[model samples]
Every structure is written in C-alpha cells, then in structure tokens.
Target chain A: MATYKLKTPISEEDTRKLKVNDIIYITGTIITARDAAHRRALEFHREKKKLPVNLQGLAVFHCGPIVKKENDKWIVVAAGPTTSTRMDLFEDEFIKNFKIRVVIGKGGMGKKTTKAMKQYGAVYGAFTGGAAVLAAKAIKNVKSVEWYDLGMPEALWVLEVEEFGPLTVAIDAHGNNLFEDVQKKVEESRQKIYQKLGV
Target chain B: MEENILINEKIVDDVAVKLLQLAVTELPRDVKEALQRAYREEESEAGKTQLKAILDNMELAEKTRTPMCQDTGVIIFYVKAGAQAKGLDKIGYALRSATRRATKEVPLRPNAVDPFTQKNTGDNTGRFVPFIHWEIVPGDSVEITVMPKGGGSENVCVLGMISPGQGVKGLKKFVVDTVINAGAKPCPPNILGVAVGGGADIAMKLAKAALLRPLDEPNPNPDLAKLEKELYEAANSTGIGPMGLGGKITVLGVKVEYAHRHPASYPVAVAFQCWAARRASARISSDGKVEYLTHKVT
Candidate 1:
C-alpha cells in the first residue's frame, strides 16, 4: 500500500521491510537473466571462474530484451519481464549463492523462491506483463552483456536503469505471496460463485 | 484453362516484412479500444494501474516503432492463397526470409532455436519456425494474417477431449478450469480463444483462429455467443484480475469457434492471448497491389 523509491544495492533491512502489495520504484543497476543465463551462472560457479560481473546485493531481472546494434553499441529497444516461473528451479540457489536482494519479473515466482525471499531478506517485484516498451524506457543503457550464445531472451544483460518500476512487491521477505493469496481467495470463492450461477 | 497469375517471390517477401513489422509495433484498433474499456471498467486500483501502464506502453511502442513486447513471439502466418497465385511454392521460403530480415530490422527477439542442441538460430527462422498455415482459395489475391504468439500466453493453451456424454457442461468446466489454473501466468485481461469439437489439432487451430476476431464481436451462432458471454462472466468473477494482482477484469473477451466432431468425442481447445493481442493482416492482389489491415495507420 505504500510506495517507496529505493536505490541498489539495497540493504537487507530495506528488503525485509517490504510487504506484498507495496509499490516500489527502483533506481539502480540491475542485471537481466533468464533460464540460460541462470544455467550459465551456475556453470560459472562450478568452473570456479568469476562471473562476468559481480552480483552480490544486486537485482536480477527476468527479462529477454529486444536489442539493436547501433554504431557498435547495443540499444535496448524493447525489454520486458519474462515469465518468472521459468526460473523457479534455479532461483532459490541463485539467490542463496548470489545474495540477490530484488527479483523483478512477471507472473511471479514459486514456493521455493518465496521461501528464499523470506530466508534471505529478498523480495519479488511483479512488473506488468507485456509492458515491454514501458519497461525499456526505464533502462538508461545496456552497460554490457555476456553469454551471447544463449540468444537474446536468455542472455545476461547488465543494464543501468533509473526509477525502473512501479513494480508491485509480489513476494515479500515475510513469506507472504500476493499471487498465492489471490489464488487462495479465488479457490475459496470458486464453488460459491458457481453455485450462485446454478452451474 | 485458366491462366495463372504469377506472383513474384519479392512481393511475398515484401508483404511478409511489412506485416511482421506492423504486427509487432502497432496495437490493433480493436485491442486498443478493448484495453481502454478495461481501464475504465476495472474497479480495483491495481488493475486500473496495470491497464493504464499497458495503454501507455502501446502508445510508446507505436511512437518509437519498437516491439510492443520483448517476446516478439513465435511468428505464425496463416495464408489463404488464391489458386492463380503462382509463387505459392515460394511463399514459405519468402516467409522465412522475411522473418530472418525482420529479426534484425524490426529487431524481433531471436526466438527460434534448435530444440535438441539448444542453439539459437540467431535469425527467427528455423525448422518449422515462422510456422505457416496455408489454404487455397478461388480468387487471384492472397490474404495473410500474422499472429505473434508470445510464450507466456501460449504456455497456458490447453486441449481437452471430453466424452460426448459429458455435453456442454463438461466443456464449460474445461474452459473455466483452464483459465483458473492458468491464473496470472498467461497475463490477464487476456483474450481467450475457445474452439470446441474438432480433433485435437484442428480444435487447437480453430481456437487460435478464433483469436483473430475483433474483441467486441461475438460468435454468429447464438448458442455459441451465449457460451462466450457465460464464460466471460465466469472468468471475470474469479477475480484473478489484471496481472493476477486481483481485480474485476480477468478477461476482455471470449471468442469461440467450433468444428463438427465424431459422436464419441468432445474436444475443446483454449488459446490464451495476453492483453497485447498482437496480430496484423494484409492482402496482395495479382497486380502486385498490397493492402494492410488491422494497423491503425494502414
């Protein structure tokens, strides 16, 4: 219910204070990663090589950006959140390993990620799904990229962003999940609504 | 013998490129209006906010000529080629070429990949990518409709084959259940395409085709139209709302189409399109004239 303007690297205390339904506008450098990028990061971990960039206390967005090459630099033309559930398998480990404080994406993550959020003082912010152009406008620049072999959607994009969201805090550090709560409410009301319709 | 109209390969290529660009950047008029209405009708503050953001995103996308979504999607083209169209043989190649060029130009995300190798195609064309569905009609003009099926909604598409004994009630259950189970994953204020009573594949295709209709239009069949309305109400009543954040507008519209089925089987397919609902259409005549429809400017 409250709106907060926060900059990264966000303190563990700030993340722990967030509650589901709180609005957040983040101004900071956030990296973008999807399934491929997550796998590659894990690969980098196993190989004992340094990641292309440091991730501790940084935010990782679930995005596959549409980027164009302009005069030898990359331009993010349309960058929107991808479905976060696709990263469900890797998120818990990623968060524990990387100390990522904020995860932004669409469609929310799963129970494992929710548990991770609570245990690790992290939060999941749900950007409006399909709002690619709007999301891109928040990104000031594509600072760099890695794992290009993973393709655009799966590449790890290191971007500098400003006031990057009206992102809803969907999963909070207290273990409350907005989506899970909504699902419970709907399930509880489902039969009653059906009966009223005489279906 | 009727003389065949020779369509140059370049014409198909040109039309394909234009159609893809328009589909990616512009919100179809029907969709724009529907989202506007959703913004007005949404009672929840969060739902309203989400709708407004989507509307703003649509406008910005058009202004900047950037894709309305990052997915840019698995490009699917349905072509109704006239019998007299000579380059019917070349249309597939033309589409692949057009898709490849658009990946770099429109800068569509390189979505195509080798399933086995997990390697990106770099271009958007791959084995059966930019998937084409073709039909031969009697005229000398070719009509093409491009639907960019994003992964979020496409992942939630479902096909159910019910026993004929289960009847209409069972079919309704299937559709409602699909939407509810899908929850916020497919992206709400979604446009739902429901196809009933074909074999598995045909049912799925019919469901996708149903999505091409304008949002406000109901099925011509009164019975089907009633079903569409009923499902629409039932879905919204779930209160899954926009982005599944909880709201009154879970879906914008329900479009239903059906095919005759065997007495033993009742098949239902549901195709979910996010609020973006990106599609564009164009027609090319024998004289090499091209006309674009479904885009605001064209």
Candidate 2:
C-alpha cells in the first residue's frame, strides 16, 4: 500500500522497497517496444550480437502508439499500454539480457516473468489499458524512433517522459500479484451475491 | 408511400472515416467532463491518481489530435439503412474502403488479419472489413454508428442461457457475479450492457448493440430499468471501484435491452466497456445531406 514517485534508471534499492500492490508514479526515461522489438532483441541474443539500445537500469513499456509527425518531429497520438501477457514468452530473456528494472503494461504477466523480476531486481507495473491518450500526455519528447517499417503507430519509439504514471505494482521483486489478489476478492464477492439472491 | 430514396454511396465511407478519426482524435466533451468529475469524487488515493492520469491523457489527445489508446480496436459499423434507399451494396463497399484508409491515416493498429496464418492484411480489412452490421428500416434516412471496441473489455464479454424459471432476479445475480468475477481484468469502472431474451447469438449481439445507447438513458422496459439500477448498486457494493483498485464505484452504469424469445429460453449476454468507451455516429439522408448523431460525444 506504500506509494513512491520513481524516476527511471531505477536502482536495486529502489526496486527492493517496492512490494506487490504498491502504487508508483513514475517519471524520466522509458522505452516503448512490443512483439516485433521483443522478438528482434531475442534473435540478437540468440546470435550473440551487440544489442541495439543500452538496457542498463531501463524500464521497457509494452506499447504500440499512434503517432504523427510534423516537420520531421514525431508526436504521440494515443500511446496506451498493451496487454502484458503477450510478452510472457520472451520477457525473461529480455529482462535478463537488458537488465530492465521496470516493466509497465496491463493485466498480469506469467510465472517466468515473475521469476525474472525476482532474479533481476525488476518490477512490473500495470497502467490502465484503455487509457492510451492519458498515458501519452506524460511523454515530453520522442527521443528516437526505431522499426519505422512497422508503421507510425506500431513502431518502437523511444520517449522521454515526465510524471509518467500512477501505475499499479502488479508484480514486485517479491513475486506478489495484484491480479491474483483481486481475483480472490472477486470470487468472494460472487459467493456473497449468490447467497444474497438465494440462488 | 412508395418514395424513392437516393442513397449517396460515398456517405458510408465518409461516415466511417469520420467516425474512426473522431473516435481517436477527439475525447467527447461530455465524456471528458464526466471522467474529470469522477476523478474529483473518487475516494481511493490510487483511484484518483489513475483518474488524473486518464484526464491528462484526454487533454493530450485533444491537444495533439491523437487517438486515446494504442489498441484502436476493430472498427464496427452499425448501419440502419432506409428500405427506400437504393445502392445499399455500394455503401457496404464504401465502409470497407474507409476502414482501409483510416487504418493508415488514423494510424490505427493493424488489428485485422488471417487468424490461422497470423498474417496482418495491412489495410485493416479482409473477410469483414469494418465489421458492418446492417438493418433495413422503413425510412428516408440512413443512420450509422461506429464503435471501436478495445480488446481488454471485449475479452471479458460472456453469454448465458438461464431457464425461463430463473426470471429477472436470476438475471440480476448473474450480471453481478459476472462483473465481480471479472475483477480488474476488464478494466473497471466499466459500463455493463446486458441483453435479455432472444437466442444465444442474438442475445450477445443485442448486448453489444445496447452499448450504443446513451450512458444516462433509462432502459425502455421498466422492469429491466429497475434491474439495471439494482445491478449497478450491487456491482459497486463489491467495492471493485474504479480500475478495480477498490472503492465505491465499480460500474458507471448498466444498460439492458431485450428481444422476444422462445417459451423456455432466457438468454443473457454481458458486454463490459473500459473507461474510454470510444463511440460516435452520424445520420445521412437519401438526398446526401448528413447530421451528426450524439451519444457519447455530447
């Protein structure tokens, strides 16, 4: 239930203090990447090649943003978080290879991701899924755009952000899950509703 | 009254493109205001924080003329064509074309594809471009509504066929249980649309169509209206609150629609909508004139 405002390039100490279900308001640098970028990064790892971006102490946001450019400058239209579960397959390898400290998206990640967070001193934050326009306002600058062939919206656009989130800590370094907690509460409430209705 | 209606084929494409662009670029004024109000009244510190982020995102989208979310969703068009209108087939093609253009112009995510091959069609159209649903009515005006339903809430939709003996009370319990069980997965403070009666498939479609009704509109059936209120109250009682972070309001509202059914069947479908709820509509006359329809965009 504790709260903290995190600036990116987070430290092991900062990550350690964050427990599951805690609320975090994040600011600073975070990169956006989805399935394609994840796959490419893994392929690079498999080939033992030099990685594209420096991964140290960085947070990777799972997103595909709608962006437009004016005078060669790219601006985000709506950059909301995509479902995190899609990344469950490659997350462990991505985290381990990049030394990623925070992973932000929606819903819950799987066991492999949880283990990776615990081992790599990382945490997963769940931003509201449909609130893309809301999430995009936090970006102050588009530092770079990679994977242009993926199109403007789906491309991997590195962004500089400020006061970027009020993200829920879905998974923490301790391997706790807010999604599991809510699911349990939901079951309890379902039972109560059934009892009240005499069904 | 054998009136010949001249349907302007381009009207359909224009409407579809406008709807897709507006769905992302504009956060309707009323929706923005309501969300802001919710943010002010939200009691959970966490909930309020999430609300603020949403509000900020709305502002950014409006200022930059960007869409509200990355999952721009499948473009669904509900068209009520006047029976007198000619060229209905052309309108359908227009819709498909508009969806393709918007896919690039609005920079909508390439959400459409071959299910088996997992290959993106690139234009956002294929088997059912724009996912058009049509109803021919006896009128001189063509009405079209566009709704971009996101994956998160769409995944949470469910259908059940309760026995006739279960009645409306059972309907209420089922709806509450569905929402409660959904938890944070569907992204609460959601809008729940319930469809009663009809067969399984029709019930689900009716439930989705019910979402097109205004958020504040009362159910046409008095009994169903009462059930809507009750389910709303019971859902909030779960303390699922906004974003399921815990608080007073789990659902913003519940809308119910019913269709006549068989003697023994009582089909029910629940469609949950995330807070974004991006939808818009337009009405076109046989003479090619058009008027914007207001639902979410008041």
Candidate 3:
C-alpha cells in the first residue's frame, strides 16, 4: 500500500490511483459535517446563496463528533465517521456544488457519488467507523466552528488537519468500490461454507 | 413485608451523565482486548487493517478522553426496579435531566427530536430524551444499564412473529438470512442479540436488553446458552467477516434472551451491535449510593 500526504488542491489523477490499503496523510483544509450540515448546504445552494464554506479542493467528513473544552480549547473525544449511506442522497449534489475533492466517511457511497467523483475529479476515502479517537489525532487544529448553538459536538467545526490518515480509498476516481468488491468476495466465501455444511 | 427503598431524581440524573461520559471516553477493558485479539487473528488484510484502526481509535479516545465515535448514540436506560423501591418517577426525571446535561457536557450528538416536524432540539433532549424501559420485580434495590445505541446498528434491528410450527431451526435460518441481507449496512463483525418469546414489542425490547449483557457471557438458561453458541458459530461461518470483508470471524458474539409466550405466537427480534459495542451500567441503592458495573472489556 502506497502512502501519501494529501493537501487541498489535490489533482484527480493522484487520488484516482489510490489503492484499498494505502495510507493517506491528509493536510490542509478539511471540513467536518454530517446529515444536518449537508442538508442545510443543499438548501442554501438551491436558493443561490453563498455557502458557509468554500468547497474547492476541500475534504468533507461525515462526522458529528463530541468535543470538550480544556483551558479554553476544544478537544475531540470520539470523532469516528458515521455511516456514509445516509448522506448518499445529497453527496453528488454537494460534491458538484462545492468542487469537493475528497470525501471521508465509513461504509461506501453510491453510484451517483462514484460517477460524480469520476466526472469531477474527486475521491472517496473510508475511515474506520469506530475509530473516532484515531481520526481525532489527525486533526491538528480546529479553525472555527459554525452553529455553536447546535452544541459542541454536533456543530460544524472547520478543522485544519495534518498527516490525517491510514484512510482507505473505498471509491477511487475511476469508480472502483473496495467495499463492494470485498463484499462480493465474502458472499462467495459464504457460498463455499454452505456447500461444506451441506445446508 | 414492606421494604424501604427510595432513589432521588438528582441521583438518577447524576448517574446517567456519568454513564454517558464513560460510554464515550473509556473503552471497556474486555472490549479493548477483544479488538486487539481480533486484530491479531484476522486473516483478511483489509479486515486486519480495519481492526487495527479501531484499536488505534480506542487508544486515542482513552488517552485524550474524547468520544470514540461522532455518533454518540441515543441514550437507552434499562431499569430493573425493586418492588420495594419508591419514587420511580424520580428515576425517570433523573434520566431525562442527565440526558440534557450530557448533551451539553458529554457533547453527545443531538439525537432526539419531534418525529413529525423533523426538528432537532439540539440538546439531545425533547420528547423521550432518555428512552427509559422499566422492569419492576419484587426486590430491594434498583439496577440500571445504559446503552448508547448508535444509528448504524439500530437501523439493522429486525422483528418477526412466526407460528409454533417454524421452531428453532426456522429461527436460525431467519437470523443468518437477515445478516447476509444486511451486508455492511449495520457494519460487520457485529454482535447479534436475539430475543425470543413475548409479543412483538416485548421481544424487540428484550433483544435490545440482551445487548446490555456483557459480550461472551452465556445466557442463564443452558438451552438458550447452547443456542447462542450455535448461532455465533453459524454467523461467523457465513464469512461476513470484519467490515464484511471475507474472513473467519463474521460475528464477534451472539446473545439470546427468552420469555414465555402465547401458545400460537413465536415472536423474535434481532438487535445488531457494531464492532464498537458501546455500553455501560450501574446499580443504585435506596440509600443514595451507587456501584458502577464495568462489563468485561476484552
């Protein structure tokens, strides 16, 4: 597995070739958002209004993490990725609207997302679902947080991250899905097991 | 014999918040060790990679005292109250208050809402902030277990009622089929909790309650325990593996709980827990004392 330190303004070519086990050390501007943020962003876009943040070469993570303040600074407790499927409804639109280059989440995105990635020069990265603590380590700083009224954890916290991954390239620019590929293999194995059991 | 046992509302709230904090910050010892073992034994390269990442996350959460996942989950409190206990409503109020405080303090995700309006109260409290399920038995003290049920695994829960003719074999087939159909939707190497008997609602509740039991802990009934073992073996044999990648271990554990049912109805409910299996519990006494019950970690 190849390893690369990714930064904003990343080219589609570099991200497209990323493999399943490749470890990525992402730096630059990464935004933390989940179901609510995505929905709001889409609503704003529909109204032809400026979004809360710019999307170009940006990485949007599917997370609504818990945070605590110590000495007046916010610290991530468990920032593990949530399931990405829930965001599937708006991902393609968000990707195209924002010029987002990398999407970090768990599970896998759908066909529209894959097509959008290929067409728009983006890549989908899969962070481990329950690995919030590990993901927090990659977060070097919280640049700012919008919707503080949404509470410390659920608020959309803009983060400046560094060396952030070990994230899998589940959906490469070419539309190959590691999750689906692996799942197919598993089904085959299951069939073999059933055969052995003669059930 | 009239027994005197009364718990204060504040005490209930305090305990709930503490439980929520622990659920997010601390990786139970048994859970941590099991993930480590899974990491070592996982043959699939991808599965091993995922397992290692989870372990790293656990380490980070503990060291930093941050939550292990962004989806802190809905707070589910399973309370078994002693028949002698007074002021049960106080316990409910405490749970609710604790949920509100934890939303701000523990920084839990705002999970509760108005079912129709689709509005998020943002404090993780609205109608039914702390979903409380109560069981009153003839006893002296109150025992409560808190499970932070995440959306991913909760979505995978299934319920069905079969005729008596279907039997245990039919149940096995249904369970396997459900997991296979679930694929990676609920996340894999999951803990499958099955509740048999009772009516539809009761069966489902029991399924969730079954999840409160520690991983690898056998059921009280030998027959049920044997069934759990069989299910666990069969689930893994499905080759669903970790994260649904092909591997030897599909399910980490299987737990089954049962109650007597009506003659014609055989109700079944399956609750799936992701690899994280985030949960914790505490026992409270009438004298306002508490004992935090830590589950076997790994």
Give the best candidate by DockQ: 1
DockQ of candidate 1 (2 decimals): 0.65
- lDDT tens digits by residue: candidate 3, A103-186: 998778888888888887788877777777788788878888886766554567888888777677777777677777766766
Query: Is model 2 an incorrect, acceptable, medium or high docking prediction?
Result: medium
- The sequence of per-residue lDDT tens digits that candidate 1 reaches over residues A51-151 is 98889878999987877788999988777887899899899989988899999998888899999989989999999988989998999988898888887
Candidate 3 true-interface contact recovery: 0.57
lDDT of 2 by residue, B26-99 (tens): 65554566677778777876566667777776677666767777777777889898887777778778888888
Error of 3 at B199 (Å): 2.0
Query: What proportion of the real contacts between chains A and B does each prediction keep?
Result: 0.69, 0.57, 0.57
Model 1: lDDT to the true structure: 0.88
Error of 2 at A182 (Å): 2.6
Q: Which residue pairs collide, candidate 1?
A: none
- Write down the TM-score for model 1: 0.91
Tens digits of per-residue lDDT, candidate 1, B1-298, equal 6544445788888888988999999878889998999999999776777888888999999999988888888999999989977778888888899999888888788788899999888898888898999999998789999998888899899999988887787788787789889999888889999998879999999999899999878888998899899999989999899999989899999999998998888999999999889899988888788888787544
Between candidates 1 and 3, the TM-score winner: 1
Candidate closest to the true structure, highest lDDT: 1
Top-TM-score candidate index: 1
Off by over 4 Å in 1: A36-56, A93-98, A146-155, A196-198, B1-6, B84-87
